[model samples]
Target: MNFDNNKLIKIIKFNLCFIITFIPSIMYLHLVEGGQTATELWDSFINLDFYSYYKMIFFLTASFFLLITFLKYVDLNGIKKTNYYLPAAVYSILAVLSSFRAEYKEIVIKGFPDRYENIFVLLGYLLLVVVAVNIVDNKKSFKLILKALFISAFILAIHGILQFYNYDLLATEFGRKLITPDGLDFFVDRLSFVGKKVIYSTMYNPNYVGSYTSMVGILALGLYSSSQKKNKLFISGILSTLLFSFLIGSRSRAGFMGFIAGTVIILYMQRQFLKKHWIRIFVIFTVFTLVFITMNARNLDEIFSDVLFPRTEQEKYLEGEILPPITEVSSEAGKLKLKTTEAEFEIIMASDQIEFLNKQPINVYNSKDEVKEIIFKGKQYLHHSFQINEKENYLIWNYGAKSAQFYYQDGQILMAGMHNNLYPLKKVESIGFKGYERLGSSRAYIWSRTLPLLKDTIFIGHGPDTYAMYFPQDDVIGKLKFFSNPEIIVDKPHNLYLQVAVNTGIISLLALLYLWGNYIFSSFVLYKNSDLSSWKNRLGIALMGAVTAYLVAGFFNDSVISVAPVFWIILGLGISLTILAKGN
Candidate 1:
């Protein structure tokens, strides 16, 4: 009996370490399907992609291990005693209650099943805290975990660098076929690098990669500073530099700002350590910054233009003169008519904007430039105007089936459609402090629409992940008009605070805040008391920095399956370290 128990514990520990090390690689190995319509029981249970499936397995394994650990050792003391556990418990309870009382029960139950999945996520994180606190009782296990993390970060960073140079290591034709044996083409299309130039790497989004690297990079910095061996320090420094470079290539503004904020906090906390190693740290920072800047100068320039001044390619076109009035207008069976200059012209518009009408003889020119004499089928015609509203100005291009229409005002392209030559107009910019209003990229608009819905469900929200169902009916967002599309459906509030408040109500949001605040505060307190010269204390300080970065980034982004696991694991590690520090 004793031998069996010892063997089981060894197996659990080995599995836990393996899961932690391989998470970064597994993030890219998703089995993409056509859509989210579940046809089987397994599909319904595990609707998300490969990452979620792997996490589910991790959760089950951890739960089983924890159950065995409890039965054999009778150690349920960790959960009962932890300072941050109660808030987490309350948050979980509230989340579960909210799911049951959800207005869109179908959405909560079927559509976006985050409500249930989130329970597992929360439990998994808590279990990690418990298991890590118990298992990693010594410096050796702690070092092993940190080393695994560094290795994962190194692999991800190298892959990202290769991807930036258009070398997709995992996305090759043969590779895709190997991963998806079903020969499903949807996975290829979904994961293929098409229009995007920035490398998403394993996380699938540039923002996610930015977030992941920001946290990992700061942790690497901690490890580098704490290492006693010259070779270990050098390797850690290289890993930190690689992660920082990856963060810059991601081009995520929120992530960049979060990383900067977190690093500053860490530096301030470890001022004593900085006093001794300031020169070396400064050199590393300078070298990495210069390298990143040189590689991404052009990308930065374009991003600055788009974010600050807000100009598009279509802005170059001139607003032409409004032509003569339309005498008559009619439409029948996918064709339109305009009667002017005592001539009736039949026009057919192309359904696809990108496909040019090559079958018909048409004279196309920049509307801003001179309007030439157009003769279609030996009928002379001049530029004609059509007004949807008295205040709105519209330019109509009539040349057989290749007709296009646009709304132009004050030398700017307001809205355009069915024109292969013209670009979509940029949104109307508001003159103000360019932080959230401008840099938020219309998230302000999404949030404004979402706030009004919270009045009815202030205590317990419409339920977890049910934001999509109700968001479409929002007065402002439902009829929200962009360049061509009049109706837009916003699935998320875009802000994590707003997402939590609207999904699970203000009380749940407060509970979540408390949970995070308590952990951060406790971690910082531990860092302040520990020996500044010790590597262990420096690591604790670094973990604090990582948590700070994740929280700041979370303000701009939501927690997803890809990056959330890492955040939780780091949080657990910090908690365990803090406890150990207190004991010492």
Candidate 2:
């Protein structure tokens, strides 16, 4: 009776920890900003209320668990003996120090202090590692963790599919609205067309959801292979299918690439297992691929036509099309009649400011507007307007001789003619896939502007999360022809490696890289040494493959609080598995 009771208590403890770990992903709760509100808190820091809440829960739960663990075990012997404890501790300390440096530097230089919440977040992750290692000490606990993860992912996958169809039953029937207290709303319409869809599921972005599903899906594959029971295999297969479908629906190029890379790694590592389950694998691949292609045919078509083979600005301008200038402006009608433009332009005059239409203007450039300098009684008058989907407003000031300076609201300036070759109005001509455009969506231009700025901050970095403040201040970036708009915030480096270098400094970045490198090395060693027939060995390989996929995806996307927790959890699991294998 005592043994049974103890077992039940253990199960309950494991279940509580498991549920707490994932509560943040699904629970969208926040402090209702009543009368007592800190306006400075809202303005000064990057709004991460959801993330902050999650970390707080994680910290409190972990602290409670640790206290219980110490009372029961009387020592931190288990964690102290683990190979990862020292490295993780060192990294956490570095991260906290980096945050301090960033906060101090930002306050001194930018006149605004950075939120050092990242320090607590990092510490929470470290505590998670310790807790995970302690709780998931055996195969039963490990399998339970996987089961919880699979179940969570399965629900999210279903949600994504329903959302893609515009049938968000949870939102409609249950009134399940995501709370965005900081005004940082993740509900974005990423589809180019009205009916087309790219599902974000419960995550903030499609890229995040894609990476998440990909990781979980790959882990499911490992679990499926390792299971001896027919029931376990059947369940895992269902999870894999659901996750893969969600990943495809995300339509994130980075996620797609990462999935492909992860799949290759899994296949390579599990080559022996494939010999027996080839038929099942083949069927899964075929069915999932067909479904993805069928659902996303229109999106694929748009990618080929709009992104890959759309006519360039030069090509469009050479077609002899010219946008007529505003000949007559009426303040009363809130409209401006251009000379010969295809569409009508609306002029809005408010707060002593005159601006063009709010939507994508009929013509991005007007050749007929020859008056470079608009002077009312010898005082230089500036015209300011914003483009569709643009973050920054631009001011048009006359330089000299039909030339104008476009000053981004953030102070970055671009000098160009009234009818500059780069700013020509062009209709997107679908010429089919002719390979990817040379520029690849202005990322190349942004990278070019960013690379030169990395020279000075190779040591201590510009401070944690301070990249956006300093990156725009670069002279070359400020003068860049394409991205001269200060309204456009370059918050992340786009590349995870570059972002790490910018935020955490080179020392911390190297330490992080070393940690990952060692994990990969150890996981590979364990897989190589273990029996091919064993499920445990295969599971380790699968985790290695998932990490590889995540690393590849990181090349294009920056880490965010929503997704980083899952990645850290996965890493912790891998470390636990490694330590267990060594003990055996």
Candidate 3:
């Protein structure tokens, strides 16, 4: 056994990577109390904790790695020349710098509530990459990391399968208790949320599950392609099938997009291998087809109504018979008029308080104090508990759990906020997809808004994880029109490129692009030149495919902690394998 300090450091690093890759799938739950000045007492208690435990592990791992690397504990010999690391470092630097420019310094530094991709987490990802580049020195280490990834995938796949069958572990007493904090068992009934979707696995969202399986499924195929022994081939092949099934179960179009992109790349790179091994590929494809057809057989109506031909939220809101019919809405000369089937409303701006007039009853709920009951315009109303916040110039009405907000700007009642300087929404700009704002589940609407943000973020951005903070939260009209819910928090740009540009500056985004582009291009060079018979070369190509899938998926999905760490680890390994190819 090699007892040298460098060997020990490398061993420690690999173990850390392995842990980081696998542990996020473990269901660790807790509770987070809302901040001080929460409008509702119920708002203070947030349940279904999934991110914090992994975050603790990530923080500790990153800090430890940084400390050891600074102390020169790694095998300096394993470090090789690569164009990827510098841009990565630049991206990290720009992200940190952007934090200084952020309005919500606390959120920017620690990360936004719930989704914590703070500066420290970003650094953790970067350090993981650094660790991978420096310490993944041999085939044995690479294989071990791959094993860890597959194990994690297996766990997630099984859990997703269970959920799909309505055997959701989280619904069980043990499962409920696992995620719930002590003394919160009485609150479990309240925490037992209704209308929850099936098959989000451990990642919290089905879209994220899609993002995860998309990457792992490709890697599984890579393993299948490279495996020599019958047992190895069978195992990898089954894992691949399960991952694809899991991806299908997630029903994330983004995941499908990523998988397709990766598969195309694999076909192009391994065209010769496919031709020789056509039967193996054929059988796998047939099984994948069967899985898709069988799983979606009962939901064919949804395929037409939701997947193939879907209506936008705006279409649903206007065309559907749900809310009261709105007859007219007009704003002019510092006065707004809104007419509905039930009543007519007039809001006039003044130096002191805005004059509100209505033919029917209008209920006003102030956050400062609760109104028992009020009568306006001769109609009587009972106790109405709602939240209304007053800003310096604007009045914000935050409605429901989705936090749909309505505001008054320039004497006009608007759906979303257009006047708040803290989190401003850019003027509407359409860069293609013009009237098709409903495209990609209203992703077009999100992009329409996100692209305009880039004009200001060319050099410095809003900051890490501050995407939600800067997003026009008050854009209720767009939300209602596009999402059918005015309170929808479009926290992510939904497009990875836009996410980068909007959150961490255009330069940082470009740097990240360069890193990915360089790595993928280098992997291609290696794939074209290297012997496929070699395990390292095969694994290198596999890692390349995995990354390609994630990037394509990124077109529709933002990076989340659950999936990003795995991608970064694979990316780092691909870079390492590229180095090995060069050495060979």
Candidate 4:
């Protein structure tokens, strides 16, 4: 009995290591099918999206148990010299605070803060990164990750093929058919109820499929350029077929752009891989070209521009000019007949506006006539603010979707809604700066206003990841989706760097700075330390390329949240970059 107990403990400890290292690869596969491999693994586990709190709890519980089991036999002799405890410690702290960090108020009323769901998820990531780095310890673990990656790619390819054929295999508990996000079972009303859940597309959004393609493209480049020939050729075939699928999956402009930029990076990094196996390179290039030219599934496109078919008249209308980019819509009422200058129109503020007007109605009235009448008779507001203040609310011509009612906190004015192309454009359109005539980034506005808020709370950032709590205070403009309180769920920081800066603070910011800083140093090391045997450089360079692509894509797309699977892949790449601490 004693011997059996000891053996069971040993087995559990070993498997814990396996699970930690393999988790990222599993998560990688989630980007396809249902956007979570664990969800599929534990399909009966939850009632919400895979990235929701229920899934986070499951990961935390499983990880905590494994962690306790592993600590029983600490590999003290194995700790690397270069690995520091600062980053790890910071992550642990953030996770703890994230537990208390109420991103939304009802989340608190509903027990999210009390239970620390977000914190647990954040902590799980910290634990994964910290422990994976410590325990992986060698090239074999790296190979394991690669192998798992191949499996992930295989799963993705299989699903992409199935999605092409319009597959639907499962039925929901609610009697709805279980279909992939972009599967043929789509109904327009799905978005009406699903929130931001993967309702419309097979891979969540077109942007997601774009990132997946870019990631897979990078991974394939690494595999094709590896020292092994058979492995290279095998991945070559799989990746080539998937590349076509990725192109078709590319629905958003940013996704298509990410792929284009990611491909260039892969091309460059692979070009400089510096291996003597020129013959293998030829085979990779030949097979990829031949397969891509011949087969059609691998062509993933993010932008509508890349589609092979001729543009429909409806598409042309949506893409074409409708009206001059609106800067101010000061009552569409004023332009009943159309006038060059301002025209007289009955002025009545909407309910939301009426509430805002009551707060500082005195701020908008200038003359004795407006002021005396208001003060004497007890009224507020006037036609214009010539004598009052220009800083008062003018008008934002919001033609896009309205803000979510009972859900997430909407952040910056520029970074609020789902469709970002139709921004206030109050100033952006005036100079005719171009690029955003269609969809473009509103990050400039998001950052300019939010940075000062962070500067004030530079110490601990409201709490971990609490930008939404403080954003409305600084946002007096009443521009895009400014909620009255903190409970509204606005998840994005819009800018990934700013999100990190606010959630983690200056020290955490420096750790990130060092990580990127190391990328530069590591790139040089990989290039120089790399001669013919530097197979690791293939992945590092591809990752570096993908990171670049993510940054560029992030300017237009939201890649900061866990919902954005690209963020996880990029984090995994950071680990992969210096996996060999003292590189050759």
Candidate 5:
């Protein structure tokens, strides 16, 4: 019985480590039919999307397996108590309660389409922390996990380098087939992800690629700094340089900032060690600098400009001579009119169809007594409701909570109000970062809007994975100023703190903050007391630096499933390492 239990524990530990190391690179694509009808603003045919579905399944299955095995091990033995439990418990309870009261129960359970960090996924994250702390009982296990992570980062960095040079492995036919399931050749052919200059590697978005490498790249440096052997040092230095080069290719300011933060932490923590080995640091920096310059030889100015001004400057909306779509109604018939400084035309809206002034009839409307909605490709994406006045006729088109109002004026259709877009302009509140609204790719705009929501979430939040449902999606001015698109959905706050505060309540945020604070404090105390020569102590510092980098970057990047699991697992390992160091 003991032998069987021991073997099971080893298997569970291996599975946990394997999943954590490889979760970022999981890109198996399968169709998710019947997407959310109300919330999805994009194509409705898919749900899991490309980067999200497989990662969720992989995490869920592995987490469940590790959790069940851990539970069995606990039943045979017993669980150890730690100071980390209180805050974890508080945060977990609040998250569960928030999910229970979520308005979109399905989303809270399964998560939003294209971004699945649902309640189950949240639980899985916590399970990672627990299992990581328990399963990693020795230095060998800990070193093994770090080595796997380093190798994964090395491979991904190489892929990112290839992508930067316009040689994306995934853009090839074989690459598409490699990511897609068998017999999905048609789906693979339909994929249009080729011809991208930026490098996102396997992490979906360039921003995410930045976030991921920021953590692991810094950790790679930590590994290099701590190693004594020449061979290990050489290998670690190469890994660090490669990873940092990948970070540069991502062009993610948040990522660069995160890398800086981690570097600062490492310097502060390993000041003595670094004083003796300053040459190594210089050599690694020189290598990365040369690589960065070589990779961006033609775009050096553009890269620097991006860092100086992170947000893309919004173009001023000049009142164009072109007229937007407008509806005009009389008792006799309804007409969709278009008038510009150059030309004017009208389309007659019949009871069930639209007829051009002198051309073919377009079967574009569904109506019994009056025209209701426009139909395209046998589907109605928006519900159109019209109101007529003595002056003009206006159309209010709604998709879920979002609505766009257009009014006919001077024979031209003019936009009146775009809900959720520029909500700050419509309503007044003491907004933060007033002058710097464009900072961090207009993260200030999102934060200014998101800050107002915290007052309502002091106790209980809307629910897990329901940030999109609650956020003001109709801020037209905000969208126009930040994104130049009045119709885009502001799905995430782009700030992890705001995401947690809005989705899981301020109380939960506080609990999580407490958990972070506890971990940092405990780790610091352990690090200060212990000798840095031991690989275990050096690992503790590396974990601290990596986790700190991730947290610092969280200010500009929200915790997505692609990168959040890595952070949580590293955090758990850090916690366990600290505890083990203190025990010694």
Candidate 6:
């Protein structure tokens, strides 16, 4: 006991590391890249920052080096050290096997810079976690983690509020400007959403606004659980806005699921104290939900159907009507048939309101109110990013009247006709709704074609970052049915498990089993182990629920293997767990 008791908290509370990690951590929620895609997940190589990657890389290596230094400084019994070592060893072995299985195995080992640059990022992260764990030895460190959470979350909450208000009071005069990995000026277009100019923070996607907000809300709930009121007003207020910000980031299923699940976990964790104040909690939730709906009600159905529904239903949506290939000779014929059918559709407006509204451009962003009034409030409230270009019919002006209304009408019609005949004869019936008529969602088809490649490499599997090399080049996507938009460059397996299996073979399965096994096993321990701290049990429940939600959401998403933040968050939790387990 060389260190003072108070000195431990001060030392464990590493401020700079927390700040840097917080900025990038919010980027995990940047699921939508300029609203073009649902998720902003990037491939491992593409994930590194364009200019900042080097800076981050330097710090990443430094963090690991610091861990090595710490291990020698403190006499860690072999048990704690070995626990940290197991994950690293597993990760390293898998990495090695994958490199050998990679299309560019030679580059991974000897020269190494050419193909396997991204795998190094994974290695760097593992090392960072291992080092961070050494700093986290006991309950006091856990309390320090809470302090880090409170400060970082408070900052993030304020940032999220400004985002909803379409005001960027932080650094730049102008609001957020998001550039692609290739530096295209695509994000400039989304100036108005629901009539308000959309603003972004260091957190990339507005959808990510939900992630940061939800995280802070969970942490605030933890604080509230302890009945600490030093920052009660600030914490509750932040949680309130976070709830509202989610609605503003419409169409993000992950955001909705993550927030709701996070909230449920919090209420449960805080039940012992919060039971009497259930009415207040309910009121808080209602106000939050109402604000979100007011800002984005058209998205309500989607939130209900897609985000809130159980996992099995979503998987069914993904598996949708897979029709056999169409070998038609004439593209013109297909287009003509589609056009004529659409024209002759008598325009069966999905609902009576569409027809009854006298067809005044039929715009509705999200509301059941007078729609005209909603249109006005929407202008004042939502679309904080861009204004309605009334001159251009394509602009979104109202919460329930602008693009959202159009999306809803179109979405419902598309859904109603889910099994509708594609052509005069027949072709892919199980098309993804909201997927444009011209091309059934390209993601599913791309995955379908890649299935065979996965089968061939089922053993050791293909290497990480090798999907581009392994993906079928001569398929319809490459040769025949090329639509525009090359940015959806799916060079790797979209399915998470499949991607893992393809790269690491049965090891991928084993890794998954281990990850899930630990989660399940730990959850049981939390429930059964009476010695555990209340905070640990609550954190465990939250993590378990959050991870479960993520897995279910991932079943329909391409999030797992890429250098996405969600995966990093999972890794962060794993690291935290490893630390939590030590000295227990």
TM-score of every model versus the real structure: 0.71, 0.68, 0.79, 0.60, 0.80, 0.59
Per-residue lDDT over 1-584 for candidate 5, one digit per residue giving the tens place of the 0 to 100 score? 98988898788878877786778888877676643632454335555366877898888888888888888988987877788878888888989998888777777877777678888888888888888888786898887788778778888889888888878888788898888777776665444435666777777777888789899888888878877889989998889988888988888777877898899888878888878988888888889789778766336444344346543222111222112222221212356543322223355444333334653223434444344343223122222223223222444443333344444444443444333222222333436766446566667878888888889888888888788776666565455444545567777888899999999999999998998878877877777555678988888888888988888888888888888888888988998988888788
146-203 in candidate 1: lDDT tens per residue?
A: 7777788888888787777677666677656644546454566666443365768756
Candidate 2 colliding pairs: 392-487
RMSD of each: 9.7, 10.6, 6.7, 12.1, 8.8, 13.1
> Tens-digit lDDT track for model 3 on 154-177?
877887877776777777888878
The candidates, ranked best first by lDDT, are 5, 3, 1, 2, 4, 6
lDDT of 1 at 88: 68
lDDT of 2 by residue, 392-442 (tens): 233342222122233222222232322231221112222222221223344
Candidate 6: residue 9 Cα off by (Å):
10
Writing each residue's lDDT as its tens digit, candidate 6 over 1-584 gives: 44553453344346324533453433211111111111122323222222223333444454455455445545433324444456456755786677765666533332111112345544554554444445554556655665565565556555645655665443232332322333433443433332244534444334444444444444454344443344764555555455345435434454455556656655654565565656656666676777766565445554555333433322443455322122231222112111110111112233233221222232444334233222212222332121222221112112122121121222232111111111112232232322222222244555555566655665565655555555543232222222222123445443555555555565655665575556545554553332223555545554455454444434434332112333334344544654465434
Q: Residue 438 error for model 5, in Å?
A: 1.2
Q: In every candidate, how many clashes are there?
A: 0, 1, 7, 29, 11, 33
lDDT on C-alpha atoms for all candidate structures = 0.60, 0.54, 0.68, 0.42, 0.72, 0.42
How close to the true structure is residue 123 of candidate 6, measured as C-alpha lDDT?
57
- For candidate 3, the 10 contiguous residues with the lowest summed lDDT are 378-387
Number of clashes found in candidate 6: 33
Clashes of 5: 11
Q: Candidate 2 at 235: error in angstroms?
A: 1.5
| 323-431: candidate 4 lDDT, tens digit per residue | 2222232223212111112222122333222122222333434464432112111211122221211133122222223221111112212222222222221221112
Number of the top TM-score candidate: 5
